[model samples]
Target: MNLTLKIWRQKGPQDKGKMVEYKVTDISEHMSFLEMMDVLNEQLTNKGGEPVAFDHDCREGICGMCSMYINGEAHGPDRGVTTCQLHMRMFKDGDTITIEPFRAKAFPVIKDLVVDRSSFDRIQQAGGFISVNTSGNTQDANAIPIDKHAADEAMDAATCIGCGACVASCKNSSAMLFVGAKVSQYALLPQGQIEATDRVKNMVAQMDLEGFGNCTNTGACEVECPKGISLENIARMNREFFSASIKG
Candidate 1:
């Protein structure tokens, strides 16, 4: 396929940026989106032009590092798929693709298509883990005997891969879906119950401190999430937060 790519370019966080256009020819339909970028970069490098910079690791889509806004959509037009998993075939010949980094105040661009997502790490650190002791031989996995329904719900919530697509797609740049997923993952599990009150309180507080906006129920985050993380998780988070607030 022949394509025109309008990609954002910036030297640093503070540098002014703009969209620069490039043309690519004879791209394979089977090529992953990043691979297509690789081809574009190679051509630019050979022409003595600076190559475009983007982030990717584990191109298989497990890493969630291939963060790109393609044609005004997070991760292109596909639902429940990340940028790394997007394929060239999704576009046709002569398609003009506009690529930009994930846009959010909390995710300021470092350069080109990379953004600093350490805000997510800080939110996770707030209370995304269990605090139980496991110093000795761990108890059998079956010993806890979590209810099947609860276990399934928790597993679904735990599938969140920490991708910032939720923030990227939100009109308010909310991290509610991501935070909700984390909270729901533990809220349904026995091990997570002990600190449930403190967990919700601290994580929500940290999320706010990170400059993420409040959820407006536009449902954009759930739509763009590569994991198909549910809006129900956000509802669950509301319940958890309200319950915790009252207790506190």
Candidate 2:
């Protein structure tokens, strides 16, 4: 298939970026979106042009590094998959694909489709972990019995890959869903109970400090999330926060 791609190009953080058009031919339908991009970059390199810079580590979709806003969607037109998992079959032969970086105040454009996502790391660092003794003396985690339902929910919430799709898809670019998922994964287990109060408070504070907007409550985040993290996690986080405030 022959395709026209209008991709965003920025030389540096302070550079003014714009969409540059390029075309590729003989693209296979089974080729992953990133693979198609590799083709484009190869074409550019062969013609004495600079390759388009995009973030991609594990093309297997687990690393969450393949971030792109394709045709106005977070990870192209596909559902429940990252850009690395997206395939060329989703587009027609004559399609014009518009690829850009995930847009959010906290995620400033670094270069092309790469954006600064260290804000997520900062939020996680705030309080996303449990206080546990992990020296030579380690107790079996299974010793503490957990409710089956809570265990399942916690495991599910823990699947979040910190992809900014939730933030990019949200109208207000809220990190509530991401924060809620992180909080729920810990809050549902007994090991996390010790820091429950401080965890939620600090994580939420850090999320706000990173310039993420308020939750729009439109449920766009869940829709765009690759892991299908439930909105119930957000509600649970709210309850945890309220309970923590009351206890204080």
Candidate 2 lDDT score at position 169: 88
lDDT, candidate 2, equals 0.93
Model 1, CA-based lDDT? 0.93
Clash counts for the predictions, in order? 0, 0
Candidate 2 per-residue C-alpha lDDT over 4-66 given as tens digits, one digit per residue, 9 for 90 to 100: 999999999999999999999999999999999999999999999999999999888788788
For candidate 1, report its TM-score. 0.98
lDDT of 1 by residue, 217-244 (tens): 9999999999999999999999999999
Residue 150 of model 2 has an lDDT of 94
Candidate 1 deviant stretches above 4 angstroms: none
